[model samples]
Target chain A: MKRFQQNIRKVVPYVPGDQPDFPDMIKLNTNENPYPPAPEVQEVLAKSNAEQMRLYPDPTAHQLNAAIAEAYGVEEAQVFTGVGSDDVLAMIFQTFFNSDLPILFPDITYAFYPVWCDLFRIPYEVQPLNEKLEIVPEDYYKPNGGIVFPNPNAPTGIALPSAAIEEILQHNPESLVVVDEAYVDFGGETVLPLLKKYENLIMVQTFSKSRAMAGERIGFAIGSVELIKALHDVKYSFNSYTMNRSALDAGTAAVQNAAYLQETTARIVKTREHTKQVLAEMGFRFPDSKSNFLFVTHPDCDAHELFEALREAHIFVRWFDSPRIRNYLRITIGTDAQMESLFAFLRAYLKK
Target chain B: MKRFQQNIRKVVPYVPGDQPDFPDMIKLNTNENPYPPAPEVQEVLAKSNAEQMRLYPDPTAHQLNAAIAEAYGVEEAQVFTGVGSDDVLAMIFQTFFNSDLPILFPDITYAFYPVWCDLFRIPYEVQPLNEKLEIVPEDYYKPNGGIVFPNPNAPTGIALPSAAIEEILQHNPESLVVVDEAYVDFGGETVLPLLKKYENLIMVQTFSKSRAMAGERIGFAIGSVELIKALHDVKYSFNSYTMNRSALDAGTAAVQNAAYLQETTARIVKTREHTKQVLAEMGFRFPDSKSNFLFVTHPDCDAHELFEALREAHIFVRWFDSPRIRNYLRITIGTDAQMESLFAFLRAYLKK
Candidate 1:
């Protein structure tokens, strides 16, 4: 049976955060926005023609592409959309990170990066983040096939300034630099403006966190026409109709409602700050977070024990069992009421 | 610029038929079911909770999987779903067709097979169909990594019997045999019953044609638990949340209303037979089609010229420029009224 498997296909898959459905649960595990999508998105869904579903959706997804481009002030040709950031990043891995040279990424970043590398048979090297979980841009200056990391690195929520990203992009002129901004809209800055100077810079973002449409599965990449074209060439070959009609219509409507994105992310950022202060009062230590999630470690409590306790109490938060971040709990910033319940439970657990 | 791409990503893409949105034009190019999906699917879409879009969809898509399992009388573990049949087939190519040995398929079958082979860098051999445009079962007896072909084949809507399929499956126990039954519900018999006899037999089907939901993008595969596990391993590594919430809900609704599938496909089969008779009367030649489309060629007219004339007359049908089927047109069986309009034009043109 082992002989039947391909060497490249042998991979331990990335484990996504638990999606438990319970009436009384306080869910803050995955970094999904705690708000519904814009009202316009709902309106779009209501008015969508069911009869049109019999035909194939637009293969190019022109309306959504145009919406994204208009919002970001980029050309439509510079935008590439997929099912999610995972799909976009996978396509990027297949398109750009194929050389014999190892691509570089942070050791404690999004776990999906390594899985994709393994899936595509791409060689990759992990540059360790500093003790504060901050990415050392200089560490990525070495020669490599490509480089990629979340903007505000996942599970850590620490962000690198756009200037640092530009410096890294400047040093690696020949290789592509992928800045996954899945969490950037929470509070962090974007490297989108640098696209004018660096043609090899590919900034990926998702509607899951800010625009709040994770279940709809909309993610995209913005870059120079050359880079976008390369992604499109590989994407069309893989699956032309990657975006469904509902996603196309709903995502376009969400993008058009920029004010809604701003308001919801603002609320999450506020709640994230309040949660940070509460954690500090409870003797938790962590770096300042720019994203919607907080990565904190309590000196007295074991993360695994607390994770199980919280699960029993119907409060779901993420605790990675990896060696590097085993002691840390990555908690998403949910609504104000949900955060209050989580904090109250934490205080009681600490006392117990 | 060419040096930036991997050798495997460099290939011509499959050209899908034109999806021109015109209110007055007749669309029979792509083999999409002209009827709308079941009314229950529309109800599901309308009543879907907008707030639920904020969270990630079930990575396993258990509801849709259960619906498919119930429909096929298989266990839930034996079912796997994806964005579309193309996505399912691409994953199949990546997961099961990775050996150094070449896989086998018909030369004039689905055009996407070679494209998938090219994308995955999988070695393959195209066995030519018999003079009557039928697959020769004995030709596939050679050693191969895997085997895959549409059951009623494509463009050429000829079907091989279940006994013939079993003969091919019996000869190839070491490798996986994929039976793509995309058009089976139209008129052909399904080999799903053979799953009990052969663990290596994997059957792939889609809701795009028979259930009338191509724009929603739902496809699945049914096989032994071992084969399904291998596919899940690859799928989880690639994209965890491949199906969106609406697709999950709507596809489940579509499958539950099996009566709709039976009615629509029966209507298509009736229209297909009528179109074939009309074509034969007008000096056209084709095989006895068992799918929703007819592959026909006129003895007195050039296919390319006829296709162009049809396009100019606001009717769209597919024409391939490939050497094997260059003189043939693949006309999708539309609603009876649309088919009558097509026949009316053909009659006047042939008389001229």
Candidate 2:
């Protein structure tokens, strides 16, 4: 029986945030936007021709690519889109990181990185973040196959300056440096303009975070034309019609409505700052987060205890049991009203 | 510059048929359904809550999986869905075909099989189809890592009996045998019932051909609980949120309207039989086709010449320049009116 089950490709899967279905739960575990997508996106979905779905979608995703390229001030050939940034990042790993040398990433960054490395059989090394949970630029000056990390590093929500990113890019000219900007829209500055200066920089962003289309599964990478072409080559080989028709239409509409994106992201930033001030008064310590989430740790209370207590109160937030970060809890910035409810629960729980 | 891309993972990408924008053109190139999907699918698209797009889609795809399982008379755990059958098949290859022995498939089958083998760095053997382009069951009775081939195999449109498939399955008990049924809905009888008997058998099907949801991109696999679990394991490791929210909604609606699937497929089969008779009278030779498309060759006319002539006349059909099938043209079954137009064009060209 064991012999019959030969050649199973096994890896420990990445566990995403819990999406509970309780109506009363103030869901904030995943960093999804509190507001709805742009009105234009809804309009496009309503008006889209269902008859066109009988035919295959455009495998090249031309219109959406054009919209993204125009929005980012780059040529269409410099953009590559996929189901999500995870898909984009996976393709990048397959296309560029085929050498025997270990790929480099921060130990405390997005958990999906190591899973992709294992999936693609790429050797990788995780450089530990400093005591402050900030990425050390000089730590990555060593020889490596390639490099990748989220811009506003996950869980911690601490972002490195453009100068630090530039220093890493300057030090590693031969290897491709992928800056996953999945959370850059809230307040983190983009390295998109750095494309003109560095050809090896692949900037991956997602409509899931900023454009509020996570359910629609739209992510893209912008880089040199050569790099984009390579990603397309691998994508075309794997699955040409990755982005379905509805996703293409909705994503393009979201990209076009620049005002809605700015308004919603600004609101989230405002709410995040307000939450930070309140948490500071509550004796919670955290880094100044540029992304929409805050990594908080209360010195007097246990994170696991707080996570359970919040769950009991129907206020869900992320808690990782991994080493080093087990003591901390990551809270996604929700609407002002939802944040108030969360604070109300926390204040009462702490008194107990 | 060459040093920058030291390990570029390159494979020959599969060339999908031309999706041209000519208004008057009859598209019989790719195997897309000529009819629109069920009205309920359109209704779902219209009424879907765009506000839900802000949240991440259900990673387990519980609703869509349940819909598919119910339609196929299987447990939800026995089913796995993806972007398309291509995506599902690719995941299957990654999960099950990771051994030292070479996997086996027919040489003249879906071209994507070898492309996937190359992409995954898996060793494979392309067994030659018999002179009639039929899969010989005896040829597969050898030691192998795994097996996969399209039923009513592509570009030939000839289906083997379920008995032959069972013989192959019985012989290769230790290996996982994947039967891709992309074109089964038109006429080919499915071996889905074999799932109860063979634990190592995986049957992959797509909505692209039968349900007319190609642009929406939904495909699924039905297998034993263990095999399906293995696929989910790989999928979760690769991309947890592979399917978008709209795809889930649209695909569920499609499966529920089983009557539409049957009616459209029956209409296609009726037209295919009529077209086969006409082509036979016009000196074209082909095997008895049990799929939605016909693989045909003319005795006196050059297949390439006919292909070009039909293209010039705004009637598109697929022509492969491969070694064995270079003289063959695969024509997808369209509406009766479209097929009439195709016949009219061929009549004038053959006369000329």
Candidate 3:
């Protein structure tokens, strides 16, 4: 081996949900919205539109930032966008998690957090969730580097209320508290109102979920002007033109068409409620999920076996193999017809 | 200021060429392609084409990678794609330059090189180019962290032969040598054929220049399978889905249309030769550039003054304010009609 090969950075990457390309498959592995992006997004996707692709996109992405600011009732200086939520969060980890102390996160949370910590060489400690699989906000009042958690915690989609997040922010005024509201549009309450109140608070959201543009790859953060500016500084240093021309144009349209977002997320919430009743009837237990997916565990079935069986049938769903969550399966909310198919399969399998 | 503010990572970002929004402008700045992408790109860009916006794009971006490999005559395992050359280069820095010794590069290279070193916290030494503004291959034969330089060596527009690059690669068997072929399609000699011979060699190319998709933001690297694997490990660790759906589809089409790439780049080379004669007749001195742009100095006019004058006339070109390049203006070759307009303004302005 070459001597310089030892200097190569070794890492274990986070595995995303499977995007199998087969016909007549039910894809509920990833929590993508089951609806297309807004008609405005489609209009901007027209070939005649965005023809200036020969040139680099505006390095600042002013039009997109401006549209997001206007839609969210924030100033343009308070907004920052990137390739995806993963890109945005990675930048945040690089910009804010440089302290000597270890940052804190929920023990069972979005899987990418620890991966990011290792990538940036940041020290981190995962605080365990309480008996009910929900974050104990009081546990975060200790001295630490920083704190970030998805608002409606993943794998078990129980959301902490805005008051609880505000309490944590109040207790640790010196810490950077990031609220990743990736699924808030489904049903979780957002602390977006607290962004202006707390100097250290940043709320990140994405069109990948409710606005239904996961294929387009757009995510953003809203915070104090100072914090956003700091993020922009690091972003420009890494890559000046990140969000491409089509992404900028389509994202702007998605953010402005607020009514479409509300309508689509409402449909998912309805499907989620119906699916919840069906799972309860089938003897499944789970926390009351506020997001678009349910973390379900059956009383008599093996999660991995069920995951395999469904995969064989061209149906896909997420089942984390981590220790505490091994018995559970995370199923995203799809259409009424798709949910009925899932119910039928579960009923037949349980009977057998 | 809050105590946590001290932990914030601060950096001075790179300043890209100005993208002014105006009417009837001759834009020669930033060196974007003067032609639109291939017609197949337009077909894939239809509003109804990428209708799977709700579904996450394939995390591996297999279709695009496979197409790139087949077109470039490399194995798919030896290829990696990202948002742009900047994104690819930034990831390369994070993955490879992790040693104690500083890396090496020419002093007058791509402006983003030093910015990346600062952002990634990699120590680096700048080996000054000789008086003629060309990279001397022997200067890179030092014990260092790694090495990377644009083949044509930006803002100077002078290219070295592949044999010269092979000399540096052979001398530094233990050091990683990255030959950025960003401007290769126009005329620069690419070191792609040497990938199998040197395991430490990586050749980076982008769609921003000759492919005419800067707004789409696609860049890739071809290297040894082991090195490519290392890059993918870091990229997956950072952001799994960087290339959007349209980008992947359009990039795959652009790579497959080899005839279009050759035809368009040939047109630019013709225009560049004609512009060189015009500039030389007007007493402008420059290197015999092989890339799409020319770095020229005029005896009577100030570079910054010429920049402002061109801007006032709604014409834009690049002028670096750094010490050695301060007297030179880097003009991008445009269409025949656009070149005539630039000459008309220059002749009228120079007379006064």
Best by lDDT: 2
Q: Model 2 over residues A8-124: C-alpha lDDT tens digits? A: 876675554577999888988999999999999989999868799998999999999999999999999999999998888888998999878899999998988998898788999
Candidate 1 lDDT over A1-352, as tens digits, reads: 4323432255565454477999999888887888899998888887767788898999888999999999999999999999988889888888888788899999999988988887778999999999888999999998888899998988899999988998998888878889999999987889988999987789999988898899999999999897788778777765788789999999999999888889888898999898988899999998899999899899999999999999999999999989989999988899999999998999999999
> What lDDT would each prediction earn against the true structure?
0.88, 0.90, 0.89
**Candidate 3 lDDT over residue span A1-352, tens digit each:** 7867998987875555577878899989999787788988888887434347788999898999999999999999999998888889989999988898999999999988998897678999999999889999989999999999998998799999999999999988999999999999988999889987998988999889999999989999999999998899888776788888889988898899989888989999999999999999999999999999999999899999999998888879998879898999999999899899899889988999
Give the distance in Å from residue A192's predicted Cα in candidate 2 to where it truly belongs. 1.3
The docking category that best describes candidate 1 is medium
For residues B101-155, could you state the per-residue lDDT of candidate 3 as single tens digits?
Answer: 9999999999888888887789999999998998988899889899999988898
lDDT of 3 at B262: 98
Candidate 3: count of backbone clashes, pairs at least 3 residues apart or interchain:
0
Better of 2 and 3 by TM-score: 2
lDDT of 3: 0.89
Model 1 deviation from native, Cα RMSD in Å: 1.7
Give the number of the best model, judged by DockQ.
2
Q: Could you tell me the lDDT of residue A126 within candidate 3? A: 98
Descending-lDDT candidate ranking: 2, 3, 1
TM-score winner among the candidates? 2
Where model 3 places Cα greater than 4 Å from the true spot, the runs are: A13-17, A48-50, B13-16, B47-50
Pitting candidate 2 against candidate 3, the one with the higher lDDT is 2
Output the lDDT of residue A143, model 1: 85
Q: RMSD, each candidate, Å?
A: 1.7, 1.2, 1.4
